[model samples]
Target: MPREITVALVQMAPELANPEANLRKMGDFVEKICTEQRTDLIVFPELSYTGTELGLKATDLAERVPGHATNYLAKRANEFNSYVVFGLVIKEKVESILYNGVVCLGPEGDVVTDYRKV
Candidate 1:
């Protein structure tokens, strides 16, 4: 028999340049979804943290993998025992280098992997 996966696709507008607020909103969605039903995976839109039109400001908001945003979502994934995936601005060791990336948090609340937009 083929296994079934319950995936939740969240479509919301992220606050511009306000990652904290965006994170809170994301958390609310996670809680609500988990409360309503079992979710195997949750996916959020691209640029879900800082919103798309950031232009140069994206550099300022970029963060490293396993950073605050990922950590926050990981907690939610662990709490709900589900996998969560979201988009974020990622920064490498070099402050100037950044990537439009997506992070996948496992049910264990750990970062499973990240994919960068080409």
Candidate 2:
């Protein structure tokens, strides 16, 4: 038999510039989905953590890899025993440098992949 995977795509309107609110909303979605069905992975839209059209505020809103946004989602992944993928603004170690990136968290709440948009 071929292997199978269950994936859920979440289309959400995240509050602009508010990572905390977005994370909470995403967490609710995750809980709701996982409660209702079996899911191996859940994916959110680009800029799901930070809304689009950021302009200069993007810099201020950018998060470090393994930062608040990822950590928050990772915990949810662990809670629901599912993989989660989402997009956010990432800040580099070098000050003021940032990238558009996607992070994937495993079921154990560990980061599996972090891909920066080219």
Candidate 3:
């Protein structure tokens, strides 16, 4: 029989006013999930990073598309050889504002898809 892939859903809260702390918190949660006895896919919260902070008038709260947040998530995913989905802030050089975004990572440590939420 083929092996079944187990999935893990991590639900947690992060400290306020500290990006580094939040990122590290999420990263650690992901690490623990992958380290469990068995797990294949790990899906995080929609606004995993930046606590899904969205600007009312501007997107500045978001991170640039394919920006640091995505890069960070990529590194974490690569380390565990598991798929992950998380949300974050996406900022664009074209504009000074940031927007909410999401990214999906494959077991190969490559980004499979990304999206910007308006």
* Top model number, TM-score: 1
Q: Write one digit per residue (lDDT tens) for candidate 1, span 28-106.
A: 9999999999999999999898788889999999999999999999999999999999998999999998899999999
lDDT of 3 by residue, 1-118 (tens): 9888888888877443356777888788878888874567788777767664344523544666566766787788888888888877666776765556678887777889888877
Q: Each prediction's TM-score against the native?
A: 0.97, 0.97, 0.78
Ranking by TM-score: 1, 2, 3
lDDT of each: 0.94, 0.94, 0.72
Candidate 2 Cα outliers beyond 4 Å, as residue runs: none
lDDT of 2 by residue, 1-118 (tens): 9989999999999999998899999999999999999999999999999998899999999998899989988999999999999999998998588899999999999999999987
Model 1 residue pairs with clashes: none
Q: What stretches of model 3 exceed 4 Å from their correct place? A: 1-3, 53-61, 96-98
Clashes of 3: 13
**Displacement of the residue 101 alpha carbon in candidate 3, Å:** 1.7
Runs of candidate 1 exceeding 4 Å displacement:
none
**Candidate 3 lDDT trough over 10 residues, lowest sum:** 52-61
